[model samples]
Target chain A: MPKETVSLRQAACTFVMFLFGSSVIMGVNSEAGQDSWISLLLAMLMALPIILIYARIMRLYPEMDLFEIVEKVIGKIGGKIVTILMIWYALHLCALVIRDFSEFIKVTVLTETPQLNIMLILILVVVYMSKSGIETMGKWSVIILPVITLVVIFTMILGLERIDPTNLLPIMGHSLGTIAGGAYKIFAFPFAETVVFLCLAGSLRKKDSPYKLFTVATLIATVIFLLVIMRNLLLLGPAVTNAKYYPSYTAVRIINVGDFLVRIEGSTALNFILAGVIKTTVCLVAASKGITRLFGLCNYKHIVFPLGLLAVALGTLLYENIKEAFDFLEIYQIYAIPFQIIIPVFIWILAEIKVRQDKAANGSHSPDSAQTDAAG
Target chain B: MNKKGKCFIIVLLMLFLLCGCQGYRGLDEMVIVTGIAIDKTPENDNYRLTFEIVDLTVPVKEMGLKGQVIESEGKTLFDAVRNAKKRITKKLYFGQAQIIIVSQEIARNEDVGIIIDWFLRDVECRETMCFIISQEETAREMFEIEALTHPLVSTEINNILELDQEVTSTTLCVELYKAFGGLHSEGEELALPVIHKAINNGKTVGETNGMAVFKDNKLVGFLPPNESKYYLFAIDEVKGGILTLSAFGEEHNISLEIFENKTGASFDYKDGKVKVTVKTDTTVYLGEVMRPYAPMDEKEINELEDIAKSELKKNISNSIKKVQSEFGADIYGFGNMIYKKDIKLWKQLAENWEEHFRTLEVEVESEIEIANTASLK
Candidate 1:
């Protein structure tokens, strides 16, 4: 089968939506209270180096995906072992996102509707999307990102009249340690979770710079993140924002524009579903590719359905209730450290060493050595 | 068709047929709950829950669109809510519920935070629903009284409280989330609107009588309608209201319409004495010059401003003193203001805030600006 490719713009759009999928609903650094936005800004800065490492790894082997690159850099046996771990991480992350969406729907809107049914329908859409391949996901992201952005912007404007500027006072109310802790919590879940995109980075069109795409996507996601946190803080006040489970939804519920446009918080559910579908679909596609490469399969499409079913089952087993689901988030930040930070940095260091050695062997000190190396 | 296409079509058909609209309910199958009232029953010590369900058959233009009020008693709120199913055929839907009326009994005995937890936890409940405390013996009595303007008593009360921001600051529009916030915050208090059945123009009607103040979870005291406006002004929540200034010589009742307000609170602690300064900036329009409108010169305008300013200061100080001395409750949120200004100071004061508030010296400063005089001038 021929390889699929997508434009850097589409990649950036998909990346932003992916980061926004769960973070927008879960809220960022709520422990910081009124200073949550400050923590978000710090988290973005903390995430930059990790994102750059992922981008550097992608540039080292232009055509090879994460699975192929792992196999090439490490030996065949070690590569297969690493490929299995990557597949498990992708599948686990996908299920967690699915669980977050399903649990949120169950708690907020669909009380009588069974969570399993919600997960099933969502996974069905994800399966169909992943089967269409990476290029279609890119195009889907570009089309949906603007509409989602417009809805969020419109909601924020409508909520402006209700916000109290004094709620944002006492800017650095929290100590530096508390703020840093809050940044670490947010960094692992949304920002560092961008490591999954390394598998799909190989699918970007040949001329696009992965660094530019990743940076642009992170910046867009960070701005949206700031707006969402600020809206919650201003409209709900610090006391209420920290109390509610979904502060954005609760804040938007109070938007009374002449009382006719009240109860528009349902738009929050729309934002969640759109971004969640993109994020889950990307995870499934990346996992399927890893599984296919591990087993020497010719095509990844055949594995998408089975892996998606596994994701549904895993989501159901992730937690018993919403409280437990949230309890898992703190543990998730710690658990994701190995996959998101440690492994990627290790791989980037190895790739840099390999690139320099190749340049040394060829006696070529040109800046275009990576391109020549890829051609070889 | 290809096998994949055929499978896709079959699965789609199965989804539509098998799922059967998971969370959807037909209009006839569900009854819309317009308002809810909770009171403790005398006999069983259980909760007496009254649901004001909207009767859809009545025309919108009808004079008395009598809604059905279902009553049930149970050990818990959800139990009582579910027990109502025995009386009504359809499930009670709360998405349209506009008001939650807590009786004086519940406000006195039960925690307001606990009473509102069921509403906040329910998926069908909107966070914007207004929370009110009924002045009558039982909240059900308030619902039983016929509404003067609207068919549903809750609707009439909701409209009146919404308009109360402009007419008077007597009734506070406390949303569900805001009430929860007040209950959850340390050293903060919840002030809710009080609804009562009153005789208005020879007919009984639902009236927003005054304000109910809660120190923690239980009702601490009541603020009369006259003083509630001052409380709102002290909090900078005076959207629009009328202030009758009579401090001038010979009791000249000049009605000033409040158009704008800005409140600033500061605290000073010296040797265990706390001094709280509340500064208020009020911009008003000359609504009425009862003494036969005279062409006001600059000197007269300044005199009017002075009278208005002193009156505002007096009203605010009286209200603060009433809440502090009578109730020993810091509903003015002086502690919360200190928390915002200086967290460390607040940390030390939060433990004995109520006691500290009682003896704390309060200073009121009002800057009144008559922004506009009526066209009659």
Candidate 2:
């Protein structure tokens, strides 16, 4: 069969990308104090030019995915080496996303539910998106995105009653270096993780969609991040947020509507599910597609069933304990920098130089291809 | 459609269908717990567990305050709740629970630490619920009172607690999570709101009298209503209040009504006796007066401000002295103030901070001003 194509709404695609990007890099609560949002915004703003670079590369070779581009950029063997590393990075990320989502659900809502069952349930939903192609993931993203936004917005409204506003005092309170360190953590986990989209960018009917969608989605993500961070700060204050692991959950529990509505701590659990699923789906798609390309398969479906099974097994057996799981995320943070940022930076620049030299050699179309208007 | 694709759609439909209907409670098996009361018995080894549960099917208007409060005797609190589960038809649902009252006798006992521990370890019990100590009556007796508004006394009790939290500091709505945080600080003593039964013409009602003071796990003493306001003010939570101040030889009391309050205490390390400076920034909106006082003049305002400051200082000082000297408990949190201010020195002094606090030099400063929406020119 022709590669199963997915028709996803631009908004949903943006939300999927935004949530996927943020989840992997940032912590629900970290040592950065109140400036966690600052790191998120900086990472997002920093991703703009890089998103443009993705568009530039995609426009140069409209029909080819990332593996083809890398192969073309540095010949077959050289391309295979980088592509193999990229493939590992993608698969590892997909596994981590599944692990985190399953672990979170198991702890939060599905306390009595088996871990295997939870992982299986999550993978079951995600398989629909991955196997059906981008269209299913995108449509679900659109359907889920609006509800998620409204839930968050509703939560923000409820939380406003308890927020003291003084908790945000002593702005930029910590040293910039500390904030930068935190920003780097966020950059690795959430922001930089968007590199997976590079795999999907070429397949977009609108190639420039990633650039436009990335910016808009990043802006939306930044606003939500600011609201979440601000809500936690206002409700818990600096002292409490620094003390608790799930500050967002505690923040919602305090929201008593004139003494009637009580203990809706489950709101954060809903959020983790909504944002976490989209993120896992993106990872699954990226990993499955990369493998199909790497192995020279005609269709990506053959790997989907096996990979989904692998995800279930990997998620179930991955971390022996919660501490090990956290250690894995932290280690991945440092390790992900190379794949998410440095390599992308390297490929982007090389692609730019090649475009320049190709312009010198082949003339106009090479240079013109990178122009902002011509990019999509 | 392919074989695998058809299988996937059917599976999705089944999963949604299964999760759509989840079981909460069966009609005959569910017993809804409305109120929980833990009180100490006269014997050292025994305690009383009181559960006020609602019959699920009854409508609030018809059942108004008619639920039975089953009392079970036990050595430990968790056992009491566990025993009650055996007595009721409906499951003990705590999701609608408003308050947990520990008798003054229970609060003062060292064994109360176990109760706080139980609160933190359980997933069913939330930290956001209000805690109270029945000052002069049994917690069960207080729960027995017929509610004025919602015949469901529990609903009324929860609402009154919420309303008072906004208006007065005397209604201390302390949560378990915050109590955990406060107790974690080695220097500070713990205090919870005091609930008591008010008998007027033999019609008893649930009344919050003051605050139940504690040193770690054990209750120390109770603050009277007036003194508890100062505690609330010190915590910067008193929303509004009225205070009367009289000169040493003045004939009558000059009352100042407070519109806003800002309170802070700082630790000063000067001598062997640690010094603490308590500050209160208050805005007073004066009510109708007694002799020798004008309601809205600058000269009167200045005089009122001075009197307000002196009165507030005296109230706080009295509470501090009573807390330090009578209770001999470090309930004022002087230890935590020192810790956050000087962690290194605090580590050295942490062990003896309680004794060091007795001689700690404390200065009370109150700044009172008249700030109204309209100018009194």
Using lDDT, give the best candidate's number.
1
TM-score of each: 0.95, 0.77
Sliding window of 10 residues with minimal summed lDDT for model 2 chain B: B20-29
The numbered model that scores best in DockQ is 1
- TM-score, chain A, per candidate? 0.96, 0.88
lDDT of 2: 0.68
What lDDT tens digits, residue by residue, belong to model 1 across residues B1-377?
Answer: 89999999998998776676586898888989999999998988999999999887777476456787899989999999999999978889898999999999889887888888889888688888999999998998888887877878888888999889877877788989888877866567889999888887887788888799887688987887898988988887788888887734657578888888888888898997889899999899988877755676777778889988998899899999999998887788787777777788877888888898899899999999998787865
Please compute DockQ, using alpha carbons, for every candidate against the native two-chain complex: 0.59, 0.11
lDDT of 2 by residue, B1-377 (tens): 99999999998999775573224344455566666788777766676878777755567576544566778777677776677667654456565566777876667655465667665555556667677677765667777787766766665666676667556656677776667655654577888887777776678777777777787568877888888888777767777766777743565455566787888888877655678898889887765365543345677667767877887888888888877777767767777667656666677888887788777777899998877514323
Q: Cα RMSD to native, each candidate? A: 2.7, 5.8
Steric clashes per prediction: 0, 13
True contacts kept of each: 0.67, 0.03
lDDT of each: 0.86, 0.68
